[model samples]
Target: MTDAPTLHFGVFEVAAPQVGGTFSWAHPRSRSADFLDPQHWIHIARVLEDSGFDFLFFAGGYGYPLVDGDLPEIAATKGINFSAIDPDYLIPVLAQHTDTLGFVVTLSTGLEHPAQLARRLASLDHLTSGRVGWNIVTGASQNAVADVFGQDAIVPHDTRYAMAAEYVELAARLWEHGWDDDARVVDRESGVYARRDGVRPVVFEGEHYRSRGYFGAPPSPQRTPVLFQAGTSPAGRAFAARNSECVFVQATTPARTAAAVADIRALAAERGRDPRGMKLMAGLTVFVGETEEEARRYEAEFDAMQTDEIVASLYAGNTGIDLLALDPDKTLHQVLGQGSVGEMGTSNIDRFLGENAPTVREILDQLKGRGTRGFRLVGDGTQVADGIERLAAETDLDGFLIEPVFEPADLEDFGRLVMPILRERGRLREGAPGNTLRARLTEQPGNDRLGDAHPVLAAD
Candidate 1:
């Protein structure tokens, strides 16, 4: 592997809006309402692929985001596209349109059967020619349990991760050991279609799940899809160390991101794996324009599209904390105490509170003005590139998971304006390289299968 401080890039998008308001779709110059159209995503895939992005990561959840404790306002106003459509259906279409771009689709381990998830992901890997990644998430919203799964209540956070641990282990066995390397012998000469010994049945009985059958499909190019985990709690970190190939993290500053990366790498080492094996990708939102003033203008426009109530509601949905009910004068520490809303959301709020100790009202103002929960980089092409370079250098991050503001236009602008600067600085890959998602992200061409350090292989 190369030791060069080269940077990688990916986009963080939801299948639909997760909030109750709109920005890009409301812009006078934007035609973003066609976001639901397959053509829109196809165009986006091509733009990102041509720009040499490593992947397009999709975020998802089950139920509508609540406003305070009610969902009426969000639903009536069409606030966010709370779980609009499945990325599983979208990835294949995107695959057909783009040759080099990787597709990372989120799947919650808390809701699906392991065997079914394994089969679906394996088929996607085949369809994408090994360019598929699975973002493993343990469901956070209690509404998902009731609305999506017909369950009564949400599973406890730590318990959900515990179940996910077993779920992934079972799925890994199906992916890794279900079929031999040469299981698919299409020889038509002898009357023998295949060897019975090549395919093996996987019988697993875990605390939360049980399965007994051979994997239905043969191994694809990557054998197992690239594993991505997005959680920052202690249990979540432990899970990532054992199973994740790429980790999605959110931090307000490069220093905080560096600390998170350091901790994850150390955890990986403790688990008998190479510290660098797990790639840390910080979540960021970018607003790019031809000039700094123009970019700031765009940022202001987007920021204005959001209101304090909508911002607080989104925050409440993420962390299970009702900011609307909070005392405006109380510090976050005094209000939140030890209870966590969700792994990723709670971590971010805690980081912000620890750093700034902003009161509830101040926090709401920050959220309203920022337009995103993570770091927001707003500038012209050169300025954005400089920020990216500095972030990579200071944090030793593998890359960023960019959350775009204006569906196609924002990304298109980045490609046309910002990418050339990044290329000139030798920060981005020069060409497509035509490889699997795992190989592309890790920069280790031809090594498509899971490494020996993974817990799945240890189970062998």
Candidate 2:
């Protein structure tokens, strides 16, 4: 049962650079393209599609909430940092150009009305030809709160998940309940665009939001975008167990990752879910070369290339603690704080990073590999493949979100060089390309819709 556990080879689309968005290796020497150059995505989409990648996602967050306490450096480097043409807009451009690549976009449940999310995501699925996926994220950063809601206001962690529960409930209803499969009958004789009896509005009234549903336009190929969640907290994990078709996790050690995987699957079982159906993806970064010596040199190049201040800003932004103010070696708990690490209670990653509390230099070294605060893998193709396989063997993860060090080339190398090994070893997903994101992922039809065990479905 564990063989070929469905690897989702993907790349994070944020254009990460050095401090306050200092300078990134991705675009350090080249002319910056519009939206970091169309070529950047074009190459990315093409490579991921050809390499048997399950999807390529663009992560989103609201506002540039700079954490430096002084926002100027972040402000100045905004163009260079991860500034983009927006993931929603980018998905379509890539969709027209690529065949099998799925595109996932991150959307915050906290800020959107369910009706709007439903409509937008459904339209995206149609536009992308059933290859769209939605990453349900509750806002994490305090600055996101200030930008999306207002200054000095933040919701507690559990409550946000509570709101998230309702948000997803409403969204699922909109996407799944509104259109029955038989709704679209184009009999030339009747010539009606849609059957009214087969289609009806979905309604939701809840504590967080209330919507009198207007059935969002015509149903697309897959009405609901593939469900995904990345929160690792108890509340977040519970949410993933119930709703997520795929889950994202991060950890430094194989032991930590293995423990996390067990916890999530346990909760999914506790909730009476088919734990096997939920594919878990660990976020990872890989720096590869033809030989081990070459790989070491490449790591040195990336190490030499980094600017300390930028790494500091990236850390500050993620931890929500001003790096300038804290003792580099001290635990965040030692300093103690008011809100969650993601604006809730302390986060798992924060605690994990805090364990032994590596100094500033160590944290930077770790991050240089994954870009964000996730796992790092560095080696040649054989070593890289072995490392990924070992992570799967040790942690029991379904697959991973492979964050890239360089643009098209890194992804190109993986799909071209690395993925085949995964496939040959049967560590990756197999079979013909699927139509909908969920179908490709789960390999089951109708399962695209939320099952009865889900809390939202129960309410319905």
Candidate 3:
């Protein structure tokens, strides 16, 4: 029999009081209220590093849904994905507190100029000793963030992705070829700091963006941060095949997840790239306990935190579809038939439109449980491990991006209970001694760089 694949583990979080529909910030067991506290983050970093997690994936959202310039009342009042302090600032701070755990921060292509973004990430790469990854998003909340950026209308979805292609190209060139490895030579005898002749400015003049300058920072442990992308659309899958080292999938079922993995790998193979090189990480939330009955009780308590109003508001904020405004008795099919969802709807909406059409009431119930986020497990250590092991065996998933329902506590429970079982089964590897995030994830001991087949290496 073939040996089971070792799974990589990461925590999905945001620099906010609550993540998604998890309105458990006010719950007695939650530390989400301490979001603004430096110690809170410091505590999280230490726990994760000590728990043997691979990285902390910060899913950043710049703004809430604004319909006709009016913010949803419940979004603010209930604290649903509201007040997301910049993760870029938080990542560096957490980097200071921990050593091995990697960080993957979301940065949108529509948000800033490539030079500024590139320089920031390169600096982070150095500061973290190369334990950094970039989760590239192409303005999923365009209309919501448009007013904040002083734009009148949402940019077309494909247009944003197209612009992102150029944006990443410029950023990659700056990281890869902006300066020679020996460009920064500090020679006291010759009174020379850097060899001017050795440094060359990487010039990129694309239709969407143009950059012609030396990279602000030198090559860090990983010249380019490990690229991660989460999109399952035709364009997104293609983009991931071409650029991402790890692809994040939130499919609702094992079969769907397996198909997505096959599709992307096949796309990569067609492009003359190694199909097995890219890793597929699924989003999963686990309510783990020592006993099956105890786990269900915890899941129930966590579910009690979400209210109907908060559910409607959070869903509206994410997909621009107001569940309350629409007739609760109406099926999702009826809702979709009324108009084109266009860019407003996400893959979550697509999942609901699958095999069976669910009513608005049914959908709201799922949202209340944070169903749209990803696959969920509610069981004891043995049962949860069984689910995880079976899913990995069936879907060929390399890992899971664990979403925490309660701040630190949920993750703490997972680390204490489920992880040990996983390790014993040989489903999780012991902590690797690799210094860089790329090296750790890829299991290469010393090399902290992207493979030659990566598109960034070919960027001009």
Candidate 4:
């Protein structure tokens, strides 16, 4: 009989509070003051490393929180803060504090030039010694486009994906072919530097972006950063299959997760790549305690603090559907079927509408107390472990991106309690002192770079 697949774990977080209604400085454990503190991030890095996590994934957007074309509700309710201080700044600091922990930082294709992004990521890979991953996102919020990118409106959904395809393609050329492995030569006797022939200009002109100069940075340990994508639409999945080594999906049930995983793997296979090489991680949030009742009590406390306005604001920000404009009594299927919902185009809400058909009230209730709509696991250590194992088995998921309800404390609880159970069950990684993010996640040493089948390599 085959052994159970070795499970990888990562933390899904932003620099700020991930959940809505919990951003207040009034919270006794609030770390809002330390949003810019290097030491605070250091502490988090150490904690994650100690827990044997594979990576700390940071998700960020470019603008402030918005609701119904304005930020009034988000400002008043203090619902989800989208203004996470740049992860690019935070990763270098955290990399200095920890040895094995991997950092995945989000960057939007619509907001930055591909060549510039390639330079930044290449520099970071060297700084982190091959422990960095890039979470690639096509822009989401119109506010981000207007406020940050200085655009009049957000790009169309399908058009954004097309631009991202070209963006990544150009970036990949820079990363993969700009500099040869033997380019850097430090020869004192000859007084020579890098071999001139080993470096070449990457010239490309696409509909959305173009690059026509030699990439400035030399190759780092991993060469190109491990590519990560989170969209689940058909175009999104195709992009992930072509470029991503890791992919994230949000599904409310094991069956949905399984289907999504299968679809992604099939896409990878169609692209002439190894499906198993693409690590598919489902987003999950867990609340753990010494006892089952204690866990429920903690969840109850969180649920009690949730407000309807906060819920509506959060939903609006996510789906781009103005929940306040819709009747609470109307079911999601009814509203969506009636063509009343606007075209914001987020995969999470799309999946929800397609799969669950929950009412507006039910959707609000689901969002109450929860930061994300991913699967929720709440119980003692054994119960949580069982839930994880069952979910993995049923869904064929490679791992989970654990979303913390409360910073550090929730993670601490999982590390102290749930990790041991997972370890004993052979569902967790044995702590390794020095491992690249790619190595740790793929569980294969010396596999530090993208596989030959990766589209980036085809440019050669």
The candidate maximizing TM-score is: 3
Q: Encode model 4's per-residue lDDT on 1-460: one tens digit a residue.
A: 1278888888887776454334433355445446567787787778888987889898887655465457745644463655557768888888888888898988988777998899999999999989999999986555535666567666666788889888888888898889888988978999878999999998998998987889989898887788999888777888888889999876667887788899999988988888998899988878899999988977777666677666666666665665666778876655564332333445756765755477777777777766454778999999998899989999988999887776667788899899888888777775465667888888888778875567756752
Considering summed lDDT, which 10 consecutive residues are worst modelled in model 4? 337-346
* Whole-model alpha-carbon lDDT for candidate 4: 0.77
The TM-score, computed over Cα atoms with residue i paired to residue i, of candidate 2 is: 0.89
The per-residue C-alpha lDDT of model 4 at residue 121 equals 92
Q: Weakest 10 consecutive residues, lDDT, candidate 2? A: 15-24
Residues 1-460, model 1: lDDT tens digits: 3345668788987767431233355676454566578887898899999888889988776755554456636434644444477768999899988888999988989777998999999999999999999999987455534556667556777888889999999998899888888878878887665578998999998899999998978898997899999877677788898889999766567787788888889998888888887788877778899999999998888877777766665665666666777788886766554444543355546655665587888888777744344667889999998888777788878888877777788889999888888877777764354689988877778879985558766863
What candidate 1 gets wrong by more than 4 Å, as runs, is 1-4, 17-23, 67-69, 75-78, 81-83, 333-345, 352-356, 369-372, 430-434
TM-score of 1: 0.93
lDDT of 3 by residue, 1-460 (tens): 1277779998988888877555778877788878788888888888888888999998886777554347877667767767778878888888888879999999988888998988899998988889999999996555678778898777766777788888888888888887777888889999998888878988888899997777868877788899999988777888888889999976667998899899999998887788887889998989888898989998899887777788777777667777787788877665664432556546667767767778889888877868347888989888998998888878888999988888788888898898888888877655554478987887767868775557756632
lDDT of 3 at 152: 71
Candidate 3 off by > 4 Å: 67-69, 333-340, 432-434
Error of 1 at 453 (Å): 3.6
User: Which residue pairs show collisions in model 3?
Assistant: none
Worst 10 residues of 1 by lDDT: 17-26
Given candidate 1, what's the lDDT at residue 298?
A: 88
Off by over 4 Å in 2: 1-4, 15-23, 26-35, 68-75, 78-82, 148-152, 339-349, 352-371, 430-434, 445-448
Which pairs of residues collide in candidate 1?
17-81, 19-79, 19-80, 20-79, 20-80, 21-79
